[model samples]
Target chain A: MTIQTLNPAQRTIRTVKPMPLARNRFERMAWIFMRFSGLILVFLSLSHFWLQHLIVGTHQLQFGQTVARWGAAGAPVTIENVFWRLYYVAIIALAMLHGLNGFRQVAYDYLNNRGVYRGVMIAATGVIAVVSLMGLVALLGGATIVK
Target chain B: MLNGLVTTVREGARYKGESNQWMWIAHRISGLGVLLFLVTHISGMSFSYFNPKVHEALIEIYKTPLFSVGELFLAACLVFHAINGTRIALLELKPEWWSEQHKATRASLLITFVLGAPTLVIMAWKSLSFYLATGR
Candidate 1:
């Protein structure tokens, strides 16, 4: 014999409860990424600044100097050592994504209209992508090692 | 008008009792500051591709003692933001660790100081020596 539970009117109540609505998974992931990338950027960017400016002396830092540091032998090959180029590329990519997300958050806070919010997000994405591409190209083009 | 202003100020000052609210606010501010710096930095660095001479000139301007001091402040902001951000990430990703968040915050602060203090001191020493030698 099964015992049934019912609310005052004598109708049996269902045991299973409705599931909660799906959460914004992507937004949650982006939020997590921001925190993780931010921590890493702190170390990467600070060290980059110290090495490039404080240690080498900012006055002495020039395009040619940066090219050499990236391991280019002067022409054609661009990135002689893949590791250094990759290191810089990673920093650029992470920074762009993290900053763009922050920009989106600011927009979400201020913009009430959905259309305007969407527009801001699109613009932010475009800017981040274009700028990151430009940075990569500059790093590669400037460091091209001609053999 | 004066009453309204006072009310507004009082409302703003009221504490909501979230232990991590101050840290969250600082993280947001520093994150925005870093973003602002990135805009200028990327734009200036991009000049290297268009005109090397202009890029070199920009680098020279940035080398000024005044900018060096600014860089130190930027470093402090980034350091605090990053360490606190790490704590937030850990708490959010590992739900089981939520109970220890206050401890995490303290740890993050300690770590930031440990790393940031030396970096600041070294940067200050270098900046001072450079300005003194150049007399700029």
Candidate 2:
């Protein structure tokens, strides 16, 4: 018996395309960010729900009482306050990273031209930087930047 | 079947890159949106510990027009992030299941739209009504 093979002209070789430079570190950073944000959110969101909704009960909460608790400064600064601060900052940072990355994804999916892609990325980075810096200031105990 | 021309036209308009790249970006953005809203929500609720007066003040603010709008935006963020997140997860299920992935994503979005629209409407109505009744 003889093995039969196709002519060279009838054969073809295919190689998977390499990823573009535009999608290197940035994509990895975005993926890592989602996991980190998801983890933080699990704790922050749950604790928040427990503290405000379940423990206190929605109807029981009112203004003066709420203010007094935060105002009463002393030993350990209180676990609740600490949690609140951490929750706020972590959520803010995660949100900035996540949202900006999402926008990049949208641009990648929707935009067609190289020039348009670059332009969109620059604009996105600018917006993310400004918003994230503002969020950081607010979360770090500065005067509230957003109402 | 989806019209071949429609699919072709839509794909034609897509960015000259992998679909995964775009999906990856959107997942990040929506996740961040949820995070941002969560921070604001927790901080605002933190006021509840301050004093009843401040708490009431904050509640009234939430009921007011401006903050009410913000709350609606937050709700929008929640819905979009959740739906999009589910889409990303579905895509990662398995290579063998890849063919059905788009169907699942579309179904998820349909369900989201059905649920989200009514919920948002109710939330807005209730919030607005409470404000009017209180005259705050």
Candidate 3:
């Protein structure tokens, strides 16, 4: 394996420059996802906050009220209804994806033990998935209060 | 984790901190805080399907003075995380400009505080009014 005694294939390898450590493609995608999702969420989430908390004021927040705004129990599929429904769905989807991925990133960062990290990641993914599913189900049409 | 945080802070107290170092710490802390809130919020709201009563009560609690303060903190965390994240993303996109990160971190933080101050006043008005009326 000495360079002076290199075979043709070995000499070819030697002639080429050393490559940089391979980047994890999944991680690179995740990094890109985080930035773009974050940029989008800034607008989505802020408007959501302004609408729900600031304008409506948490004082007036109620299940019936939300059901109404969420459309149907509130109103028919008018433009306003469609707008709010779409808005809610967008925020829910993006925020959940962004938040859970962020949680995973931190878990990878601080949890050095492979077994522990795996357990944590599995549990987190399952829990977040189930909860988010329930949210989407309700948003689509699961239950709206009679009131 | 709390112990680790305490240890890191204690150890780092020996040296003068760099702005980016402090900014990174703030970013992690705020991100984690928002993540926790997101979990609670989605989980709670998801109950609106199966248990509208529970959803009502949970959402109601947020209107209380105590919860208003917590909401303020959550909002602050969200705003800062969003703004600082923009800074990080910008720097990452232009690696050559990382040389200007110290300035970026300062500017980001100043923006966070500027945004946060008005937000605090506006939100705190709700909290103060609720407390004044109910003494809660």
Worst 10 residues of 2 chain B by lDDT: B46-55
What TM-score does structure 1 among the candidates reach? Answer: 0.76
Top lDDT hit: 3
Candidate 1 lDDT, tens digit per residue, A41-131?
8678777866875677655566666666564435544445466677778889899899898877766665767887898789878877877
Q: How accurate is candidate 3 locally (lDDT)?
A: 0.77
Worst 10 residues of 3 chain B by lDDT: B1-10
Backbone clashes counted, model 2? 26
RMSD of 2: 9.3
TM-scores for all candidates: the values are 0.76, 0.53, 0.83
Reference-based lDDT, each prediction: 0.74, 0.56, 0.77
Deviation from native of the Cα of residue A101 in model 1, angstroms: 0.6
Instruction: Looking only at chain A, give the TM-score of model 2 against the true structure.
Output: 0.56
Model 2, range B72-114, lDDT digits (tens) per residue? 6655556655665656554654567777765766676686677
* Per-residue lDDT value at B39 in model 1: 67
Candidate 3 clashing pairs, residues 3+ apart or interchain = A68-A74
- The number of the candidate with the highest TM-score is 3
lDDT tens digits by residue: candidate 3, A1-147: 323536765653334444444646667777899999888988888777767777777776766676666654433555765676677778778888888888887776667678888899899888878877877777766346656
Give the per-residue lDDT digits (tens) of candidate 1, residues B1-136: 1343354347545767355766766777788787777767776776676566776778889989788888888878878877787788778778999888788888998998997898788888877887889899
> How much is the lDDT of residue B109 in candidate 3?
87
